[model samples]
Target: MNTQFIKASLFAAGLLLVSTSFAQNKNDLKNWPSGYAPLEVGKRIAAHFIATPHTNFGRPTPPKVITYPESCTWYGALKFAGASRDKELLGQLAKRFEPFFGPEAKLIPVPDHVDYSVFGSVPLQLYIQTKEQKYLDLGKGIADKQWGPPEGPRVVAASHEFYKQGLTWQTRLWIDDMFMITALQNQAYLATGEIKYIDRAAKEMVVYLDSLQKPNGLFYHAPTAPFYWGRGNGWMAAGMAELLGSLPKNHPERARIMKGYQMMMASLLKHQAEDGMWRQLVDDAESWKESSSTGMFTYAMITGVKKGWLDAKTYGPAARKAWIALVGYIDGNDEVKDVCEGTNKNTSRQFYLDRKRLTGDLHGQAPILWSAAALLQ
Candidate 1:
């Protein structure tokens, strides 16, 4: 056979396999294809998390690769722990963050970025699982650094630029910050039972959502970047759910936040491609299917369903489809595929259009865990 014929044959076979796998009714839990268990998916992602050398929960930087993505990995680890009866799995995950379990161990937190607060959850999750006062103190302390009495909240307000007439990331209005800032604040609220922490997170959610959400329900990547970057909207969705989880029903802003989150999901469902993934540029027909955002969006959708924040009849099947499609991206070794690498706000739509893809990136791995945990719930 000629080279072109061989390639075509292989492609055709791949399509057949995927078609058979996804042909079942997604809403029928009994009919979900084999090997799609949420626990199994969580385990696959966790195996990768164990091998990951990016985080050191005990110190400021021992694993040589700590960042918000690493923090996200641990957050998912906590979720995985919750689903499994295995306390050891939870412990194994918490040990990495043990450095923050004590008062003496201090983090040299990254400044002027919501990513810094995102990392606080590493310790905070440990505190939740262990109930060690030190972990709680550590979590709250880390939180204070983000929105604490001294300068944390002020810094974010001053640093985060609100969008006016144009789309931009230079201001804090970017959708990605919605998750980064709220991750820390929500965890802090849980750790300390402090209304202020939750308030800080809740307020930021409104700020970002109001500023970035488009008339179509999706959000722009930033003021200058008008493109609907898939992962950025994923961040907004997940962040909204996280905040709502902590916000009380009586809170005045809960209604607005919930309405916006629901509308966002509606928009996302419309854009979901035939294979169950969203494009890098969410609304663009020509853009390539992206995974990290798919994973984050999966986390958002399943979470909303579990929390009763979304209509199960409408979102349940969509969540299942998203999860199944995302599973296809994992290799035998547990590495997530097609994850867009770390990104920044860009003035041009083409910047996101031409972004590079990576495997085993924490941005993808962490959200997969979060989604799997919720699905199993």
Candidate 2:
């Protein structure tokens, strides 16, 4: 046989093996890291909470929304914990935030607008794990209120932010939206058997992806920007990981979306710094290595390996190296260090590099959790 034929035969055999393994061990497949219980990491994270004069119940709340990445990270960890081991500690975390819903949820000042995208996800995730209608209802209300009409065949904006005293589409679709909105929408679809949520998410994701693609197959930070942000790419990558999990295997969009992921991964691999961490702007080495983006990308690559979207032989070593570099950014308590604080929309290279780095920030921690979760799998 020719080389092409041999390669195709091997690919088919690999798929067959994977399918057989999955069918044989569906329950065992869900359980990760042989010999380890689910949510063990979550319990460890919860135990590290140190009550400060400012934080209530030892829960650390940084003043900025970017700092709250841990909330979502912990939220994911909680869900995995709940699913694998029937733990209630994860549920308690959701309950503590219940009082903050509706009129009680306080708004932060920096962004001026309530980040429904971020807030919406955690409650929705909680709803999935607990089967609690209240959490679902709360998430639905927020989603409904914030969701922007579909912009075209593919674009939708759930909210907008103010930049340069003008109302730009706060809907400036970035990769992060995949994590914040698509996952929630997918869960809603599963919970309600509603096609609208999934339909909307799919359309919006396509629009966002189309707008960001560059000639080199890498995605830009936004529609108008030439720069590619690592975290932004990470968001989209991680988003694809989640979407693939939920989407049916035969969905028409599946092949195209998977191709897009492969192309992006190819470009991303080329840009990884020597240290294994990606800078704020992926192509610029002058920019410092930032943990949030690196962790998210690591999570994406690792998930790709688990899902068979990426070749483990090719990407696994890179991911492992990135994880080691990422661990260096974590402090003693697993708090993330040298994380870029929340940034406004910027179109320049300097703008990306100049974003401030904060230690033990939640934005970094959440991605760290995601990376850890992926590694565990």
Alpha-carbon local distance difference test for all models: 0.77, 0.63
> Measured by TM-score, how close is model 2 to the native structure?
0.74
Q: lDDT tens string, model 2, 1-377?
A: 69999999999999999999765543231344432332454344444422211122124553433223544565556544554454566655665565555544563212222333555666677777778888788666555543543323222333323222222223456656666666656666666667666665665567666767676666777666667776777778777777766777776667767777788788878888877788888888787888888887877787887778888667766776676677677666756777887766678888888888887556675665665555555
lDDT of 1 by residue, 1-377 (tens): 79999999999999998887666455543335678887777887887787676554324456543577877887888877877755978878867666543642454354335676577787787787788777777567667765433343435443434323221122366789888878877888887788887877777777777788988999998888888998999899888888887899999889889989999999999999977899899999988899989988888888887888878778878887888899999987788888887788888778887888877777888888888777666
Give stretches of model 2 more than 4 Å off: 1-71, 83-88, 101-103, 106-114, 146-170
Specify the highest-lDDT model's number.
Answer: 1
Question: TM-score for all predictions?
Answer: 0.84, 0.74
Best by TM-score: 1
Model 2 weakest 10-residue run by lDDT: 49-58
